[model samples]
Target: MGGNATVAVEATTNRPSSASIVQTLGGGSGIDTSALVQSLVDAQFESRNAALAKREETLTAQISAAATHKSNITGFSTALSTLSRSGNLATQPTSSNSGIVNVTRLSGAVLTDVNARVEVRQLAAAQTASTAPVTDKAAPVGQGTLTLTFGTASVADGAMSAFMPGAGASVDIIIDASNSSLQGIAAAINARNAGVTASILTDSAGSRLVIKGGSGEARAFTLEATETPGEEGLSALNIGIGASGTTIGSAAADAIVAIDGVAIKRDSNTIADLVPGVKLDLVSAQIGVPVNIGKTLPTNALLQAVSDFVDTYNEVFAALNKDLDPVTGSLKQDIAAKALKRQLQQLTLAPLASGAGGAPTTLSQIGVRTNRDGSITLDSTALSRALVNSPDAVEKMFAAPSGAATTGNGLAAALGAIAAEAANTTRGLGASEISYTKAKSDIATDKTDALAKADALRTRMTRQFASMDAKVAAYKSTQTFIENQVKAWNSQD
Candidate 1:
């Protein structure tokens, strides 16, 4: 009979059996068992690993945005500090005759409307002592312990009078076989930073050792040589008046300067204590001629400072606003960035410095106007008027230090605070990076765990499926033998 249903009978029961189904389906289980196990293991871990990867990528993007936010804050701070350090915001001290006396302001001293007259009587000089001519610079000068003592020497009637030793430690220079020659001794003395310098100068007569001292009166020194046994010519370098060619080329003397005809003596040519807020460096002596010191017109300086500050302020706000934009992907609706943006906008109206009554304290008072779009503009005429009326106050305000970050309103201090917070390692700029890195690390660890589990599943399932397939293959062979036996028995019957 032609029929779709075809089966084999069992030997004992003589009924259609599972062996017939197996034979019809082909050999064994008729499935790629190895491929099936691999697909199952891949399915278990693929979705989890993909989720971890996506999270890591998002963290990376957030860290990049944090860097951008930090850049803006620090840029604002550095720009303000540069402006203050450049001295473009202050009224510097000016000298009428800069050739004679140059003026420099050392500190944030308010020298507004202050003037002074100074006259340089004589400039300070350094003392130089030359020894007698030597036939050979490399020849032995004898061994000794040369002691140098500093003192102030006096002269009366073109002759030596009295000597007063300075209250300083005496320096002893040792001369042995290694440093016994005039050149060697000079090298030995040069090694000491004891306010004394020595060198062998080859002159018309011969080579002579010359010793020079520091430029102050207290630095004048006299040499005493204590000779060792059999050492000759050691005392030749000693000072009495002293020796044949030993002479003081220039005596170290204190500088004499006059402030408004009042005499002042200092050990250096650069004088600062005579006048407040300014240091006067004497170039040459002018017997009675006076140099006038005064303040310069800082209108142009204020103009440029105002311009730079406005532009920088605008830039900082612009970048910060972008980061805090609600719809933007980067730092969207970030609380910290939003707060910083508001604080930066407030800096335009914040007081810059402390001064006398009626001074222009804030940037707005001095003509900086904020626009609707967060940018700012300067009014040159208003700034000039402030300069004309309150010149001292104007100088006082601009001359103030860049505000600190926390304590004061100086540009450096106030702006520095914001910058510090932005890049702060624990709680600010670096905090987000730390979080993202930690998350990425966790993702890596989870991926490792997931892979380990997947590997174990693949191994266990592959072994189990192989065992099941082998048992099923044996059972099918047994069923086929029984089915053939039943047919042969029926045919014999």
Candidate 2:
């Protein structure tokens, strides 16, 4: 029977539709919509946070770089200061001529009776023949044992030999068999700190060994066994009698010289140590029963100074360029860096090309040159030649007095000026530069503050998103209840 369907009971009016609930809660899709929104927001925040973190890292790197740059600048400044204040530069000897001059040349008279003199003598000794005996005819000839006696003390073992005082003259003998190897024997004798040399010599006459003491000392020789006899007995070998000791003598002159009225002693014959900037060499010494000294001017020192300056300048310039060049991705990327590079380049090349007064300025004049890399290279050789040819002219170029109309500056003075400018707080952006220091501080502060702000914002955003998630969850439950009631009513109908 087709009975009329019973009318279904409607759910309570208090129940709201899913759409209505969602609309009241600001129109979000039903599936954990708050969580999704929060996730997106959190992702955006993280992205920003990551960007800020990178920026802070970059800032930190920059600060470190700035500190390093400042240190380098300070080091350069200190080096420059030292160079400027280093009184007069030391002189170098000329290569072509003898590197000394006679004291009499300056006095216009023969300076005789020099106090320092070295004594030399020659030693003579008789030659002796020695031989080593082998047991088997087939056995190769080998070195035999040698016994040396000094006063009562005697040494027996392998032989350590060397020539006597005079070369191609007499031979000295040393007994060096102390339970040590040949090398050890040599080491022990050398360690004695006695000025002597030991060596072994072999010839068609067989092997001959010798020892020689230093000049002014006598060396003695004695031999116990000449050759390796099959018998171990010392008396069986019948080594020959040794010669009496003799003395070898040679002398090196004292290195003291008088310069500008100051008497100074040095290790080398060159007079650079006596005069702050003068290097003199001994040209000729005529033996007049009392030697007569000859004098020569120092010309190499000035040339070398200019050359050294140029080389040093170029090295510094290359370093500066590397630091400031943008293509290399160097840490330095500031106006000051650029300016320093420019200044170095200018300074390095200026001496080579610029002229003072009416004279033409050639690096050959001052002792520097422009290298292939557009940098300055010191032509020490050319400069030296110029100085030898015209020392006074070279000196004038570097240290000449100024005229009434124009004030002249020397190389030392110019370097000092550059150093002063570098040290000036307002000039280059070096360690003393206010702007550089301020930038360092300001960037550091900005990075710190930005990081702190980002951290705080992230924490607050986290809490807000959590609260929104709870509210969205409650709204979802209410919508589920309403939809379930509508389903039940339709089923009953």
Top of the candidates by TM-score: 1
Instruction: For each candidate in the order shown, give its overall lDDT on alpha carbons.
Output: 0.74, 0.42
Across 1-493, the per-residue lDDT of candidate 1 in tens digits comes to 1121123222223333344332322234667777788889988888988898888787777777788778877877787767666676776788889888999876666665558888888887667877889889999989989888888876433223456788888899999999999998999889877888998889789998888887777767788889998986778787534344376677778888888888888888888787787888889888899989888766777767767777777776777677667786566745566656767777767776675677777767877888887777888788788878776655554554532334334656677777887787777766765776787788889889988999899878866775566556656766776677789779999
Cα RMSD to native, each candidate? Answer: 6.2, 13.6
Residue 168 C-alpha lDDT in model 1: 84
**Candidate number with greatest lDDT:** 1
CA lDDT, candidate 2, residue 136: 32
10 residues in a row with least lDDT, candidate 1: 1-10
